[model samples]
Target: MKAVWLAVGLLVASAASAQDYAESDGAMLRFLDKLTSVTGDVTLSRGQAAQFGRLVVRLDSCRYPVGNPASDASAHLTILDDATQTDLFNGWMLASSPALSALDHPRYDVWVLSCILPEAATEAVEGE
Candidate 1:
C-alpha cells in the first residue's frame, strides 16, 4: 500500500509539471473536409471566427511548449454548422493527438497547428 501511494503521488506531481504554453494573440489551424476530400489551413486571432464550408470555427486561444514550436499544440475552439444552426464542437483539440479530443462532424475535421505569439512575447523570447 505504501509503495502504491508513493507511485501515485509521483505520477500526479509529474503530470502537474508537464509542458503547457499559452499564446495571447492568435492560432493557426488545419481543417480537413472529408466529404469533399479537401484540406486547408486558417489563421484566427483570439476570439475571432472563420468560416469553412457550412461550418463556422472560432478560436479562443492556442498554446505550445515554452520553446519548442513543433512540440504538441492545443487550441480551444467552438465550431457551429450554419445549415443546421447547431454547435458541432466546443473544446480543446491537440495537434499531437488530434483524435484524442476531436470534432465529431461527418463533413469536417479540425486540429491545431500552432499558436501565433504576440509581438511582445516573441520579442521577449528572442531577446533572451
Candidate 2:
C-alpha cells in the first residue's frame, strides 16, 4: 500500500511540473575562450552540433517556463573534447544561474542563454 501511494504521488508531481514548462527546438548559448576571454553566442537546434576551438558542443533540447519563456532557459547539452575524444560535459545547464551546473574546462566555458522556440510555437504562445 505504501509503494502504491508513493507511485501515485510521483506521477502527480511529474504532471504538475510538466505543466509549468515547455520544450523548444533549439537554444542560444554563450561560449567563452578562457585563454583569450573572447565570448560569442552559438545558436543550435536540437540534434545540431557546433565546434568551438577544441570543443564540440551539441544541443539535444531546451526548455523554459511557460509563463516567462525568455526569463530562464535550460538545455540538455553534450560537449566533447576533440583532441581527447572524451565527453567533457553532458548534462543540463540553466541560464539564470549557470555556475550552479557549469561546464568545467581549462580553456573553454559554455552556458545557456535562452531557449529558441519554433515559429509555430512562438505564434501559438502569442495567440494564447
* Candidate whose TM-score is highest: 2
Which residue segments of model 2 deviate by more than 4 Å? 1-11, 119-128
Candidate 2 local lDDT, 5-59, one digit each (tens): 9999999999998899989988999999999999989899999999998999999
The clash numbers for all candidates, in the given order, read 0, 0
Candidate 1, which ten residues in sequence have the lowest lDDT sum? 16-25
C-alpha root-mean-square deviation, each candidate:
3.3, 2.9
Worst 10 residues of 2 by lDDT: 117-126
Q: Which ranges in model 1 have alpha carbons more than 4 Å from their true place?
A: 1-20, 118-128
Tell me the TM-score of model 1: 0.76
Summarize candidate 1's per-residue lDDT along 12-88 as a digit string, tens digits: 98886564565647888988999888999998999999888988999987876766555667889999998997989
